[model samples]
Target: MSDRYAPDVQEERRAAIVAGLVTAAVGFTSSFAVVLAGLDAVGASASQAASGLLILCVTQGLGTILLALRYRVPVTLAWSTPGAALLATTGMVDGGWPAAVGAFLVVGLLVVATAAIKQLADLVRAIPTSIAQAMLAGVLVPLCLAPVTATAERPLLLAPVVLTWLLLAALAPRWASPAALVVALTLAVLAGDDRSGAVWPGLAWTMPTFSIGAVVGLAVPLYLVTMAAQNVPGAAVLTSFGYRPPWRAAMLVTGVGTIGGAPAGGHAINLAAISAALSASPEAGPDPSKRWVAAVTTGTTYVVIAPLAALLTAVVVAAPPGLVAAAAGLALLTTLAGSLRAALTAADRAEPAIVTFLVAASGISVWGIGAAFWALVAGVIAHLVLRRTVRAR
Candidate 1:
């Protein structure tokens, strides 16, 4: 009876349900830009690409729900939107969907290995919270400027939505950051940009083709970027809320989810931050000790929704591209800034961080993998070499 009637317990249950759905929806919305890029990279027919994203999303959403449920740790899992962007420009450039899927699998394996090794999470944990916070801010900075960057050739497309995003974001962060996107999409619909209001992806699937290009360009870089950019921050989010999730369990879940999503075109799976923010609040569970159930509930919901993913993707595609870009870019500002700071600060490692930041910011491509992976590698190597002599001293 106490368990049933406890206000905090009840509140937490309520928050879990609400936040789970909101996270799934917002995460799907947030991921569209990279999905678009991935679709184009494979040179898929519009309908095929659209369907692929739907499948990818469903896999990601279902995987998130599963991991969340298994650990009951509020472990919000999401595919790497940034990973998709990398695939779009690099991996899929020379390859097709088959190769793209191959990349996904390889990367998923890497994530699993990281978990098995248990060293990756530990390394990230070693960083000071102040440094983590700074890194997050730095990563998110460019995302803030993305809207402005797209305006030159696409003002007609990006202007109104970007303006609306800026107004709402500066005025009311909580309401604006997530809901502004829904509102922007609605306005786009009223203006008739939603060409496929009712059309949805019919049952469709693609078999993967293994290729060095996809593996190096799409898979390897995607894995690295998602790990550094998304997973690290996700852990920080949990820690910030005073929960230290079991790294082995969480990484295994992330790895499993990534593998599951690979066949369907997913990029990577990592823990959540902003979305998980909902379940971690005091309202979700006053005890905080028993908050695992909330994540369980969330993961279960993702699985339930998986079958209908194509339908959901159809809905996501209805929004105008410009509006989608603006909303996603806005939503990610904080995150991008955070990554940037991590890459930049560190007086001893400033040079490497700068190199990493510049390369990532440059948006260049090498062998079909995006710059984020290279940036991280570059930074890591620089940091190691520079610190080696100091440590020896």
Candidate 2:
């Protein structure tokens, strides 16, 4: 039989398509609430948040398709989940939503600069992994507590969502968040929560305005977290799967995508870390070289579902208070646990990491700069001081 016609090859192709669809479905459903909350937290109106979500889906989807086909690698991309979480926690910054939009543009430029300027790349890389992870862990702490807090405030409304999440977490861990979201939306409908008028999709473009505080507080931290948490690990995952990722190209693509979507309220987009595994792993196909099909499928799936963003946003907007947060919170628990473990695992760096975590979790803002930036600053200082003391000893 010809190689193309082989039974095994056909099976692999089928597997790849299925894996891609699953990747898109899981990636979109799992953390989208976090994205909405982040945009809303930054002062985006309902239309703006929906626009942001739409642009995010469209840009990353197209970027993923382009990269995967060009490189013949399963190069998946995602909106920066950690960055969104940072926005949710950081709240409204110095110049409100316009400034936040400006910060998103800056982050995109920085990403492109990272690809083009070796010195800038080295500087970003020089930040200690422990400190970076600690900052992320710290930033995630409060958001991860949403389920507990929501339960306390609205037990009756959230109980079904929480129970659905718990049951699926045990039986089908990957579906837990998505399932919980469905339950929440269902409850919202049953309660007659209505926002049908806002379901039409359109760009809610905002003029970008720069400010010193937003650049430092929002852009800098967002860039670091997206790099440390998503882009870096995404490359590592592809490498582990035997494909040499085109790093420069990947950064340029995601960076440009980020910029293009910024005015529409999308925060940032980058290479996918967690969802990359769905299309890059052997589960996509036993033949390593053939997995790009899965990535193409993933991207296509994202594009197809991009129009639903407005509808989803309307449902979430009308959901019972704390319900969406509970779902988003549950989605992030695994990420939080992983970040905490990575942050504290090194005995030598424990103190600095702890310092970083505490500062971030404290949710402090000084001179209009948020805790994420300060956490990194404090962690680095602690690390330097401790190292010098040891050297003196």
Compare the candidates by TM-score and give the number of the best one.
2
lDDT of 1 by residue, 70-153 (tens): 655666766666555555445344467767777777877888888877576566555433333332333344545656676665
lDDT of 1: 0.61
TM-score of 2: 0.97
Q: Tell me the deviation in Å of residue 17 in model 2.
A: 0.4
lDDT of each: 0.61, 0.92
TM-score of each model, in listed order:
0.79, 0.97
In Å, residue 255's CA in model 1 sits off its true spot by 1.7
